[model samples]
Target: MSRRSVSTRGVKWPIVSAVGLHGGMDVLELRAEADAILAELVGAPGGSARLREDQWQAVAALVEERRRALVVQRTGWGKSAVYFVATALLRRRGSGPTVIVSPLLALMRNQVEAAARAGIRAHTINSANPEEWESIHEEVERGETDVLLVSPERLNAVDFREQVLPKLAATTGLLVVDEAHCISDWGHDFRPDYRRLRAMLAELPAGVPVLATTATANARVTADVAEQLGTGGGEALVLRGPLDRESLRLGVVRLPDAAHRLGWLAEHLDDLQGSGIVYALTVAAAEEATAFLRQRGFRVASYTGRTENADRLQAEADLQQNRVKALIATSALGMGFDKPDLGFVVHLGSPSSPIAYYQQVGRAGRGVEHADVLLLPGKEDEAIWRYFADTAFPPEARVRETLSALAGAGRPLSVPALEAVVDLRRTRLETMLKVLDVDGAVKRVKGGWISTGEQWVYDSERYAWVARQRAAEQQAMRDYVSTTQCRMEFLRRQLDDEGAVPCGRCDNCAGPWVDSDVSAETLTGAVKELDRPGVEIEPRRMWPTGMPALGIDLKGRISAKEQCSTGRALGRLSDIGWGNRLRPLLAENAPDGPVPDDVLQAAVAVLADWARSPGGWAPDVPDASARPVGVVAVPSVTRPQLVGSLAEGIAAVGRLPFLGTLTYGGPGGAHAARRSNSAQRLRGLFGAFTVSEELAGALARSPGPVLLVDDYTDSGWTLAVAARLLRQAGAQQVLPLVLAAAG
Candidate 1:
């Protein structure tokens, strides 16, 4: 309760070395006081808490010098400790609550608990707790809260930004940006919401110390983030330490294919020290890996963006409490998930970049003395990486189109309305708009987005540079899996870490510490699990809103009468099993050929299984229509022979008649609708499909459902519209069957 809690003259803080021993008496006193406060923050008594030199340097910069600092240290370096100690010291000096712009809910939960241990009253306003927002805001307003954590996305929220942010900026004792690298576009996980931090930084009063910390930033990202932190015109203190984890024993076991990778995990996952994460490249892969692991009797759960918030929370808790062996996860579980004693991190496929891989693996070997880090690189890694690469900064033409649309609208248009005019998908479109908003080209208002009349030029050169850098990083990951150099050094060099050197512990440095062999029995089981095809294709239940504005007749929900029944696909194109085969067969430039015998046989197997499934076919459900009476193909602009042959083969196999194909007459035909958002796609295929007279007569005469066949399904809207046509032509039901699903 001393008035001079933080040393104004940088004096009286407890010293751990001779340098502090030589300081003035006041310096000694200040050091002592700091040591005591650190003890209290760490839930220890009698100055038991100690700070590392780098940690002390950051704390001193913020408390003693009242300066902004960007600490780009590795994870488990006590970045949170520096901020919590600073907040306590500043609060004792009569400063207000520290406002932390955190990036993830998991991180927030951890911070809140950590703060409570230090007797700091911390609360968060995120998507999880709407009911508590009012009470939390009241507490913040009444100065009852010591630390306030808000997600980056909350910065642009209409109410929060307008009402609460300005006040917090004016009076906050400290401004902390956790996971700060997210603010830089050059960073691997750049988020548009993080860009809003620039606005927050601009609004902070002079002399309010700011701290931004991130564990995975490369040198370029570090410099960019430091530059952004200089919003008040003063240079930021950059406390960057060497990126190395002594406890991590890194190794790469290059597996031949998906089955081997899964088999390796099943065989060796339990042997690796403790509970950890099993990273997958895609949601489909994560689910598949989770199922396969469970079948092998490993307790696990799948975590992905598609998982509900409640389920994600439960999964994180499960891992923290060691109730599950691991969380088979996609990138959604990547950043900000903290567990000090996580014992292992195994990747089913190599991440595209060394930096990203380092970030994911850093979660382990944190508190434990020794942890296993393994990379089981797969053949499909590069393709998945390219799929993500395509979503980066849109082309110049697309940018111009967006600006033009906003400028011409004379009013704000929500994302859906914008999609009607722009061809970009919803995610990419929203990302572009956020970037534009941050660049002052547009502004988010009450209704939607509006042009700010700012002349914007697309930075083609910068984006191209980023693209090249991505390609180079991908190559570096490829090298990491195949190289003989120290795995740690290879990753460190990718981050431009000055201390990059051989760790003498990786497989290359230690003669393969991890076993790469998988038992034949395990491999066979894995192959069966993967090769066992058939994924349920859930039909689109509702039409996208605002279709009328785009000159499409569809709106609101599609009555169950016109909707296609829940269908089935052999597999997802992103899956590890049939995905490999389907990728080549469904490639953009793949030849127009008849369905391969293996794939045709697989399709027939799917149908046979579907018929026996409960609630499937005529008598399975009392109210449901009977089994498919005929087969009809949807003409494919790119693969007519494939669709035609598949339909004929299905009819020939099931002993059903082969109805004629649906004619395609729209501009560019079926090929033009290859990639589009729901609204745009609906517009593209609204009138493109029509049932021929012969098919109409066949459907009218048919007493049972028709097996609607297609080469592939992307949006499922094509099947929906086609089903409507068939049902209108008197078909009982339209059971959609496709070769692959576009997840």
Candidate 2:
């Protein structure tokens, strides 16, 4: 279809009017009206704030023709603007409020604010605002809201899907899917929640125009997303643009190790152009980097999935206002965070894929003329990638097992209940359930999941291809870090950008613009900071819900008297310092041995510091009974020597009795419980450990708290169980102390 530009009311709007029309308004008149609405939405007057040709085409397809469209453009290419403009134009036509399936809270917040600026009222119903959902739903029903933003995860919520979604789908004027690439398993970030959109799309009224947008989709992902958008045989218009950002000056700084990389950031972070992001591979790494940077006098905050919602919002605000030099973060802070003047992005470790890397770096240089994008690849990166790689879709056997369990249950089974029957972890089981739900193999009801009894064939080949893709992407990331070619060109090529060319701004095209040299003093300080270990071990206060259904005798909150007190660990297994020192000692093949002298010394120091701190076990109690009277070791099948030595060493250092080891009753008990869910772990260890007469006498003699030591703590159930036994055996208190915590 061709368009004719038309002028209207002192404003120049692109109007495409057709002769011998298709029973619709003149294309030109529709375009003029859309243009006027776009101008007003962007807070510009007259001819200003005009929509780009591609943007206008997508908008026209959605509004004028009432068609489905997918727009794959780079970050900051105004994808949100296209949807907002369409919402305004469609609302003026007396259509119902636009329903936008946004991917993140940050994105929703940004969209709501941007829509308000454009004079389009919008509200969000997400996990963060459960209290506001009822009122928001009322507003939507009242026809008072212009746009309603709901997270994809909300699409599967029983009440929302059954109650609000049908109404919204039947009456929605326009449907928008932000970060639409997530719909495809082939996409860099495949969210099963997004897959539920297929059902949502199929449920929508035939004429309800749909819009899907993303910045990181490649050829495969683009096709997949476009296909998903084509529900009910509606052809979706795919509008893709070049994926190059000339403003990003890309470079890779190869550091020798985690310390060097951390030290380099600590030394040169301020020298970077402006405040930006420091991405880490894990939550522990983020916290470590944030702590080290703060010690180095740079105001910074840690942002990760673990960060509280309020803290995350504040961290975003801090970065936006330039209060903090950076926010050391995980992938949680990457997508949908809009900061126009973001000046730099530095990775502490390489992500698994170049596409993921490119997407993250896209956060920078969005509005500025130039922004720095540096990758400080670490030796530990590949291991971290491998750790995350386990999240891949499980084998067919496991999928079949889950389906069979649900089918046999005859009723809805919660994820925890499924976990009791399936060997998968909680996260993996939940993800599998979601994928199954999307595939129609299962349904999520109010109670939990019930098998739909659908014949679900596992796409083994597709999963294999995805696994291979992950490996290839990991190798590509390696290539990107070591490539002599232009970094920007390399990233663009990975995204299938045809216009991939050296931008003469990267270190390969030009020369390194950042300083990699770190002073000895700074390096030493970084090492010291990382080596200073002592992370609080917050005990599990409440038992998991629905445990009785899993054949476990546990429910509701664990009584305070029966709980293990908040304790300490030498360090997180993910820590930059002790993590390196502890990994080998705790490896699967690692021989059972005594605690190394250095590690033992460090553990002693941590204990000393913990005992003297203001928040110590008996801070200011002056009860003389504050100190731990004895040290009890949890028996370790794999590391008995290590556990025994650690307890003995602590007792000797603190001049306390060394309570004998807790006895293991079976050949394969807690040792076999690794990687299992809580219910399985609890069952495996219920009476596996016995309080020996010797240890019982030691505990009885020491009515005060006794230090319960273990080689490592994973589920914390082991410690909890041991602590409960010790308490039941007449110990006044149980203080858990572990060498490492698997976070």
lDDT of each: 0.85, 0.83
Candidate 1 per-residue lDDT, tens place, 1-743, comes to 11222221111223344254335776555556666666776666664456655677787788878899999888777788889888988898899899999877888988898788778999999988889999999999999999999988888887888899999988899999998878988887788999998888888888899999998888899999999999864898899888988889998887789999999899988898889999999999999999999998999999998999999999999999999999999988867788888999999888898888998898997777789999888898887776666667899898898899999998888888888888888889989999999999998888888899999988889888878887888888888888988889988888889998999888888888767799999999999989888998888888886788877777778877777788889999888888888998988888889999999999999998888887775332246646788999998877889999999999998899998899988887685766787888888888888988988888888767888999889888889889998888887788899999987
TM-score of each: 0.95, 0.93
Count of clashes in candidate 2: 4
TM-score of candidate 1 against the unseen true structure: 0.95
Candidate with maximal TM-score: 1
- In Å, residue 629's CA in model 1 sits off its true spot by 1.5
Cα RMSD, each candidate: 4.1, 3.8
- Candidate 1 regions off by >4 Å? 1-22, 25-27, 40-43, 617-622
Considering every candidate listed, which one attains the maximal lDDT?
1
lDDT of 2 by residue, 1-743 (tens): 55655332222335333334333557667766766776776566575456656677788788878899999899877788788888998898888999999878898887788788778999999999999999999999999999999998899999998999899988999999998878999987898998888877898887889999988888999889988988773878888888888788998888777788888998788788879999998899898888888877889999998999999999999998999888999999868898888999999889999998988998997777889999998777776676667688987898999888888988898887776777777988888889989999999999999988888889989989988888899999999988998888888898888888888999999998876788899888888888887888878777765567666788878876677777788887776678777877888889988899888888888888888877577442334337888889898878888989999999998899887888889666456777777776776787788998888887777788889998788888899888888888987778888889886
